[model samples]
Target: MKKHNYSAGPSILPQEVLEKAAAAILDFNNSGLSLIEISHRSKDFVAVMEEARSLALELLGLQGKGYQALFLHGGASLEFLMVPYNLMTKAGKAAYLDTGTWASGAIKEAKTFGETVVVASSKAENYTHIPKNYTVPTDADYFHCTSNNTIFGTQMTEFPDLGIPMVCDMSSDIFSRELDFSKFGLIYAGAQKNMGPAGVTLVVLKEDILGKTGRTIPNMLNLQQHIEKESMYNTPPVFATYTSLLTLQWLKNLGGIAEIEKRNNAKAELLYTEIDRNGLFKGTAVVEDRSKMNVTFLLEDESLTEKFDQSWKAADISGLNGHRSVGGYRASIYNAMPIESVQVLVDVMKELERTA
Candidate 1:
């Protein structure tokens, strides 16, 4: 049976991208060696790295805008530590917006470096909404926020204009919509979500933001060192970076973020519309704050859970189960998820309601 994948991370990728990646794995660039066996410093892989970085900036409208894109090894979790290590001064503080589990995890990492202030949080409300009207400390080294919450399905529509550098973790929603990419001092995302796969993380930052924290950052955690080395301070994740390059190429060929955003909006609308209109279901996140990537919702009749589960499973729907913390269904309609797949889920929902 054909499965409609809705897993949150290491999620669905474009079918063409997957096919190309599989081909490369068997014979990268027609070379007899597998992509994994190639040296990171080789001419072919170097070209791949350079083009991937360049394409990332080009797609984001950040080219020639003093931004450097680095495809790093550790996931966004490492970036949580690297952010403060390379940006926060020995005495300087950092401010963060607590929007979800990952945002809270970032705050926890920052606290160990220096004073970390949570400017605003919706945690008390179970993170169903994004906190607003909160103040970020102007004196902080940098301000941090997560663009989207995958587990809870909340996204920040507007960002505050802090005089200080603004940092963001766009792990769940990067490249899915149009945004003012220049406003951010730093942006990082795990490739597993919308980019490529789990082994690589994309970090884009302004060149001027580094080498000012007054803390001696370790070479591995140093952004400037990685930049100077051109994202090759050590052996990079070969397969992950190449697959990400293929994915970026796919996006560029399909127009860009502007084009993908339209498809994403249509998918979100299709699913959320069903969740709201169907009497059997209800949305988990606030209407205005709902995520275009991950759509979290619940069945109105909890007693019908088994029937609904069986229904989706029978239809060959996978990864519809929500996180343990949320305890409902989450349909992660990422950039690559087709509207046709969404309609399948909506049909399942409608069928459940009719039979119940």
Candidate 2:
């Protein structure tokens, strides 16, 4: 049985994208060979690459900003180090907000390269809510922020206003909603969560922000290098990047981000409302800061988690278990997750409530 997938990264991709990806794997665009067999430098493949890059930038309306979009190999984990290396200068300090697991990881990695300042942190409250009222550095090299917290189920309601250039890790929520990119110097996200697959990562950087770090960054890790080469510095993750391109095409056909944002909000609201009203369940995130892509909840009886997983599986629903670090249940409702799927899970939750 095909179950509703709620895995965080490498999560769910649209069915249409999957179907088209499979067909391309066999023979892409009727080129008489499989996409996997095509040369990355081939004309046919190059056209696909250009289209993908164009669509990605077009989606963000990044035409006027002189920002270059790069679809590269390695997940966002690589970006944690690369962001600091390329942006954090020796004379400057980088500011980071400790939101949750991934944000903390970014902060930890940044310290090795330069002086990092923690502007705000929510660890004392167990990261249940987004921190409000924080100090933003005026002279910092760049301010790093995570738009969404996957493990703790919280999201930054309003990003901090820092005078310095803003750098963000949007790994889990990029392209999920509308946001102005003019305020950010750079934004990086692994494509697996919101775009398509596991092997590619997206980085959008403003032209003015590069070449300012004086430190010597490796060729592969430099944003300017990737930008100049158009993300084909090496062989690149051809298949995964193309799948992301196809996904972007699907998004455009579905009325772009506006239409998808409506659906995403509705799906999140439905699950969150049920968790809020359900007698045996309680939400792990604060109402104001809950993530629209991931709904996290806990049973009154923690011991029943395993049983809840089994029951949901028997009902043909899966991937609802929460991350181990912050455990109970996590329903990652990414863009591809349908409202009907959320309804199914809500019904299952009601059933469990009545039986209990």
Candidate 3:
């Protein structure tokens, strides 16, 4: 039986991208050199780097608008520190909206560099809903938030413009939907979920937002230096970056973010309808705050967990387990995931309900 992948991070990728990536690993561009063995400075690899950066900006609709896109080494977790290190100063204050674990992590890092005000948080309700109607102080140097919560399965439907720089960690949901790209001063994502595999992170920043913190940032941590070097300040993750270029090409061929968003909505709606209609399961996130990328639900009867687990596994479903904090099931339907896989999961749920 064919298997369906729903792993949250390092998640599913387009089949063609995978095949192309594998071929490059053996003999990249028919150069008799594996992608892993090639020098990042080589013209072939440089072309890949340039194309990937350009494609990222093109997909976000920020081309030629003074926004630079960089493919870097650190994951989004490192960005939690880089954001504060480069943007928040000793006297400056930043405002953050705490939606989930990643948001809280960012807040913790920002507090180490400067004052960080948590404008709002849903922690009071175990982060089931996105905090709403909170005041973002105008005095803040920038406002930061996680666009989507992978752990709690909540996503911010709307973003607030506070007249300050806006920073977002879009790790789990980037390229999955369309958003106002111009509103954010910076957006960072680990290329593991929707974009590609692990090992590379994408950072898009407005040129004016950098060089304002007045603190001396290390060369590696300085976004300006990375941009100056054209993301070749050092040997980049050649294989990962090349794969990302292929994946971005695939997304562009599929009609970009608008097309992917439609499929994402359809997949989420199909699975969520099954969860709501089935007596054995119920969704975990609030109805209005549900994430289109990560659809989280739980077994209504905890005692039936083992039976349900076996049922889904028997059907060749993988990675339905939820985060430890949530203690339920999470279906991470990213951009590369087909609607048919979602239909399989829905059928499994319906089968469980009928058998029950």
Candidate 4:
């Protein structure tokens, strides 16, 4: 049976990207050496690193915009601290928007450095919606927000233009849709969601934003040091970075973000339309703030849960269960998820309705 993947992170990737990555793993560039075994300092890997950095900026339309893209380790969790470490001065404060678990984690880390302000939050409402009425203090070092809440299925469709620099964690939704990438002063994302496999995180930031914190930053955590060394500050995640490069190349060949956005919208519409129209189901997130990447919904009749679970499993559908915090089904239709797979889930929903 052909399985339809819907796992949230370490999620689905393009078929072609996976095939290419598999080939490279055994024999990279026909060099008779595995990609993981090759030295990071080797010329072949250096070119890969350079191209990956360049292509990330190019895809976001940030090239020639004083932006430097770095593929680093430790995922977005580490960036929670690295952001404040490199951006927040000893006495300066930072502002954040609490939209989901990851955003809250970032706020917690920033507090250790200095004052961290949460301008607005929907946590009071179980994060079913994004807070719209809030003010970012202009005196803050930077304003941070998560573009998508994978856990709650909420995404920020619009961003506030504060006078201060804006930072964002785009882990779950990066490269899935079109956006004004240049508007953000800094962007970080773990590659597992939409970019590639786990183990590498992409960091794109404006060069001018660094070296001004007036505090000593450790070499490993310093954005300026990583930039100066051209993202080769240490032995990088060779396989992850190369696979990410392959995925980016795939996106570029498919006409980049503009093209992918259309497909994402279509998928979201197909699933959400079913959720709204079906008598047996309804969405969990607010209609206006629903995420295009993660479609979360629930059964109207909880007694039918066993039947519905069996139905989806029989159809070879995987990763449809929601998080523990939200009890329901979550269909994470990311960039690489085919609309055909979504049709399968919708069909399963309709079947449950007809037999109920």
Q: What is the lDDT of residue 171 in candidate 4?
A: 98
lDDT at residue 336 of model 3 (Cα atoms): 88
In order, the Cα lDDT scores of the candidates are 0.93, 0.88, 0.92, 0.94
What's the best-to-worst order under lDDT?
A: 4, 1, 3, 2
List of clashing residue pairs for candidate 4? none
Tell me the lDDT of model 2 at 322: 87
Off by over 4 Å in 1: none
lDDT of 3 by residue, 1-356 (tens): 44799999889999999999999999999999999998888998999999999999999999999999999998998999999888886689999999999999999988888788999999999999999999999989999999999999999999996699999999999988889999999999999988988999999999998888889999999999999999989899888899999999999999999999999999988988888889899898999999999999999899889989998898889998998877799999999889998998888888878888
- Indicate the residue-level lDDT of 151 in model 4: 91
lDDT of 1 by residue, 154-235 (tens): 9999999889999999999999999999999999999999999899999999999998988788899999999999999999
Name the weakest run of 10 consecutive residues (lDDT summed) in model 1: 1-10
Give model 1's clash tally.
0
Report RMSD (Å) for each prediction in the order shown.
0.7, 1.1, 0.9, 0.8
Question: For candidate 4, what is the lDDT?
Answer: 0.94
Q: How well does candidate 2 match the true structure in TM-score terms?
A: 0.98
Quick one: how many clashes does candidate 3 have? 0
lDDT of 3 at 89: 68
